[model samples]
Target chain A: MIEIQNLTKKYGQIVAVDNLNFTVERGEILGFLGPNGAGKSTTMNMITGYLPSTEGTVKVSGYDIAQEPNEVKKRIGYLPENPPLYTDLTVDEYLSFVSELKKVERSKREQQISDIMELLKITDVRKRLIRNLSKGYKQRVGFAQALIGNPEVLILDEPTVGLDPNQILEVRNVIKDLRKEHTIVFSTHIMQEVSAVCERIVIINKGKIVAVDTPENLSKAITKNSRFTIKIAGVKASVIGALKAIDGVKNVEVSDKVEEDVYEYIVDSDKQVDVRKPIFFAMAKLGFPILETKEEELGLEEIFRELTTKNIVVSTESDNSKQDASGEAPEEDDQAEEKEVE
Target chain B: MLSVYKKELRTYFYSPLAYVLSGIFVLVFGIYFLTQTMSKAGQGIAQIVFGGQLFFASFWLVMLIPILTMRVFAEERKNGTEVLLMTSPISVPQIVIGKFLAAFTVFLTMTALTAIFPIIISISGDLVISNTLSSYLGFVLLGASFVAFGLFTSSITESQIIAAVLGTVTLFFILLIDQLKTLVSGIFLKIINQLSLYEHYKQFVQSVISLKDIVFFVSLTGMFLVLVMIVIEKRRWSQG
Candidate 1:
């Protein structure tokens, strides 16, 4: 279990983490969500006893980080943003060193190391130098290092940042399995990873907590206006005019033709309106058959954008457009993989 | 502490640092031994073991100590391994002492290799065993102090080259203090002479084991190690 109270970190005049108060219970996986420079990593660094908080106290497993650092540190395992690896060492040597440093019992050290290596799937590269490993392997090695001592808490920063889709899924499943035994707090900008693995989500922006809730509740709470993308097999003008004439319809935007006769239109509806029934009846009367009609549910992506960028309209528009163009769900995973390859 | 000491000692052999440092050490000490032996001729093995040769070998320590210790902490910080070290269950003093002893062990091994010179002298001629033992004791104490200073330097800087330079310059000044005493007089001269690192070695070179000199070298080594601990403590606060 972990508790942070009125925690703050300042560098000169700038505050990196400002008055953050959150608690993570035992065996619960908490996803830390934020944009770049949102102090997600800073908060994690403070929680793990890696960086001392300037203003407040962090208590882990009933030990204060400032007053009893070694005891608190003994309970937490941290994988910093950049894995702290000695490239000159082979995988076995590096992990052995880590095991020793963490004071893992000598009798069980070999067993623990092998078990972690097998779990992360880095056993084949155990004898190779860490410097020669690919980015994904290096990330797993970092993960293995954090698991050496079997600490009660695991704090991972961007655990799946550079892995391919398969590797990401493997890491995700491994983390999901780990949740039964360890309290996990992992930070990431990727939205789907949070929804897939975390039990509770803490959304942070600009060194402050914006919202904290379950993923389903978060999406439902932030969505005010409902929009539907409806594809109709008819002329665009009559369909748009008819949909606009519906009472609950707020606005209509029609897209260019995909085929000769099929067209796409986005219909905006006021809150608590069942425009689907009205639009279906109106288009039915107009003889414009609806090809596809589905209500759009807000994903974590839209929720994140809405929470983080409350001031800049243009940038939020561009962010949404970029997300839409690339089909935001899988694009980040592919981009991180591509960057790793290059 | 034992685990960290073991890992550091093993790490030296895994890289070329330990071997390269020993190679340079043997080459330099070998040259000094042969030259001093040839010059002394038939004056006996005491001259070969306790005279100018041992004193001159201490000079090689200026270069050797820096090379051996420059990478101890600086390299760890650069590779980000310091995070792994600092966040572990071990305290800062344990880490520092572990690294310091490892470097000192390397220094002792190099000195042990040079012991063949005394053995050869004893076989071919009369050798004073007590004289050689005291001289070796003095050499160990001197090396301990130098290693401590170099380790302290390494802790304050992230760049190994800077650590090496700072260590060499600090040792160079300590070495120069013996000669600088000749230019002053009265109490000032006595104080400057007392500050010389080589001054404490004179009793051992004269085949006399004095308690004051032994305590001086030991306390000096302890003082530097304490300074290193303080620096590391300050780093923890400043890093926040």
Candidate 2:
């Protein structure tokens, strides 16, 4: 329901968000995964029409953000990184104010406000001044403010930053429930949040998109081989030799000895190849009994670290090479010394 | 725009600061009424309304307006709530005009309370109703212009203290520009004298509701309000 093309934001000499192009389909929950300063918030602000991009265009449901911002803004409910709140007002007062600002129909304003309060579980503290509420409560109130008009699009930045573990789970469930009605694009550095709630993930680093895919596909795409850990009732050398000799087996290494007779080995097979049937037949022929076997898949955390860290390493290596070529190599030597000290 | 106007109006009534400001506002006007009319019984009610007493009360306006308008935009920017307002479907001009009218309404309400002074004078002696009405008109126009100036200053910064300080200093200089006319000469002196903010009120206080004076205050208020809109609009372009 949203399309952004060549979105770039520059503050004088510093480019905050550079040529970001992405889209969110209707009713899709797209997770924006990035480290801090990855331009996630800047991109969101530009999409919500809060900040004008230096050179870009955002279209929300066929309306251009620059040309028809009012229509675009009417459809977006943005929860900024720092919840924008007037602390002097009560929770109910703030929500109603937001409802009015969002221009909810007069007949449905009260019902919408109460339903949002109920959804966020903030009804008990509705009468309390926002400044007096706890941080988690304040964050929930911010969420409620965004949900006031029941907008078609919800853009949340770090929706669960300071909440307790239970609250985080509650918020995730609420967002999942919201996905049935609204298209969502939320940003967070927490890998588990994306895996739990988002259907697709877009990983960004240093103002550029690094990868975009479903969580499962992202993890599977990171490595060329499918790994398997198997324990067999056989000598380690024979089991390793037999596993390596399989047609689809790429590599095998001894991992552990569970007992005097049983040994565990990690086996790597060619991509999209399943070695279980061949291993079982071969083991039967060799008189080796199989005890346990399980496939290993990469998790979101590993995929994220691999993607973000690779960019850092590549950039730093290029920087070091450039410094060496320029005869300004002492900085790299100093960095090496610092690394050694660590 | 209506939403912002109503929210700001409610904030004025809900905050204790507004009450304190209104109380001090009435007290200052009451003192001026007592000294300028009650102590001297022979002066016409028109004279009291048009006197140096009401003119000096404009000084109190220069001091009190910052309290009303300093937090209009500055507080929102500081607390980051400008995000909510700016991102709403409302345009920048709507936000500026909504806030300007809110502050001006509070100033108008405070000045309206001084109507009791004119009523008391009318009951006790011969009061020229036309002059009284005209003077009240002048006071409203003057207060509205000062509020516009304060709101303009508030829009330029995120610190309420700086907005208030700059607003007070700028209005104070405008209030004293008439005094500086004596130091200059010829056409320059006349131009500076005419530009004096308080000088415009002289015609209104004398029971003269000339279109020239009304246009002067209205245009001055409009000028500052337009500047505020420009400042807020520029912010959208420069911010990322």
Candidate 3:
């Protein structure tokens, strides 16, 4: 188990991590989510004892990292953003060195080195210097280095960044296999990869955590208006006419025209409202047959955007209301009253 | 400590670096030995031991210092292997001492191979056994200081080029401290010049078994290794 409490890292005037708090229980795979420069790598560096936090504590399996670094280091395996590999040594020789530094018994070092290479499927390249291996194989060699000493915690920073599609799946599968025993904290900017591999997501933005929730709940909660987009082979006026007349449709508008006859329209409804059946019937009655009616899913991407951007949106109405009451910008009071309900 | 020592030592032999540097040392001294001994210039046993040890001691240290110690920590940081060492359970001193021992072992092997010079001189003429023994001891002490300088250079930078240049330059400065004493007439300059590694190696080269010279060489080696340890410790504070 890894417990990070109020972890903050400040580099001069800029704060890279701002009082961030999160935890990974045994057997939990947490997807560390953030945009570029969102402190994902900094946070991982702190947890793995690569860099120290300006404030707060990181405890690995009940051992305080700062107080007992060797204890914490013994329990955690870190693969930094760049794989820290020795290019001169062969893979087998490098692994043996790491195994010894990790305090593996001399008797079990050989067997353990072989087992880790077998696990990552790098046994074929074990005799080769790491400098000669391709990017994917080098990454696997790095992964093999982490698996030495069989530490319970694994912190991988962008594990599959440069891998091919097939290699990405294979690496994902290997991480999943390790999930049964190890507490994994893997960071990535790709949301789809998080959804595929992570059981929970902690989205970070601008040095602060925006949200922490299950992927399904985040997707559902952030889809506020239940909006639907449909492309139909009909006139814009008729499509809007058909959708606005539905019982549960809150608003309808023709968004774009794709072809001479096909139109793209947006339909907004109340939360939990399904207007596909009503729109199909109304369009059929008007003699404009519905070509497509599919609900637009508010995926992890949208949820991430909403959570990260919520702070800066001042709503414009609040500004106007304050100005109208205080007699500031009094000439715009009439316009402000017009938009009071906005 | 043992593990890192083994890794560093294996790295020396696995690559061509160790053989190349060691070959240069033997080759330089081989030319010197052939001219002095085989060409009949090393007529007396005393002359053979005195000249052989002096030639081997200086050049062996100059070439081996840069090649053997060039990559100790600087290369690890550049090639991205410092993360493995820092995150491992081993402490900083263990790593410093381990790398030091590894580089010193290579120096010892180089020194051992030059044993052929003394044996070759002995085969042709009667050997001045006592003088030959002190000359070998003198070479060993000087080489130990070179190993210390190699590691100290490696610790100061992440670029091996810079490390090699810095180590060679620092050794050169210490060697030329004698010239400074000659140029200046101050008492302090004379005292500082006495701290030079070559200045202290002089007494033992003439087969004078002075304890003060032994102390000077050993203390210089110990001081540099400790300074390397302090620099490594200070780096962790920056991370914190």
lDDT of 3 by residue, A220-256 (tens): 6666677888877877777787688788788987877
Best by TM-score: 1
Q: Rank the models by TM-score, top first.
A: 1, 2, 3
Q: Assign candidate 1 its CAPRI class.
A: medium
Angstrom error at residue B165, model 3:
1.0
lDDT of 2 by residue, A126-197 (tens): 999999999999999999988878899999989998899999999999999999999999999999999999
The Cα RMSD across the true interface for model 3 is 10.8
- TM-scores for all candidates: the values are 0.90, 0.89, 0.85
Compare candidates 2 and 3 on TM-score and give the better one.
2
Which regions of candidate 3 fall more than 4 Å away from where they truly are?
A: A229-236, A245-266, A270-294, A305-342, B38-47, B184-186, B208-212, B236-240
Pairs of residues at least 3 apart in sequence or in different chains that clash in candidate 2: none
Tell me the tens digit of each residue's lDDT in model 1 across A82-177: 888888789998899999889899999999999999999999999999999999999999989989899999999999988999999999999999
In order, candidate lDDTs are: 0.82, 0.83, 0.78
Residues B40-131, candidate 3: write the lDDT tens digits. 66454344554454544585576568768988988876775777887889877888889989998998898788878778767766677788
* Clash tally, candidates in order: 0, 0, 0
Q: Give me the overall lDDT of model 3.
A: 0.78
Ranking by DockQ: 1, 2, 3
True contacts kept of each: 0.57, 0.76, 0.71
**lDDT accuracy of residue A85 in candidate 3:** 88
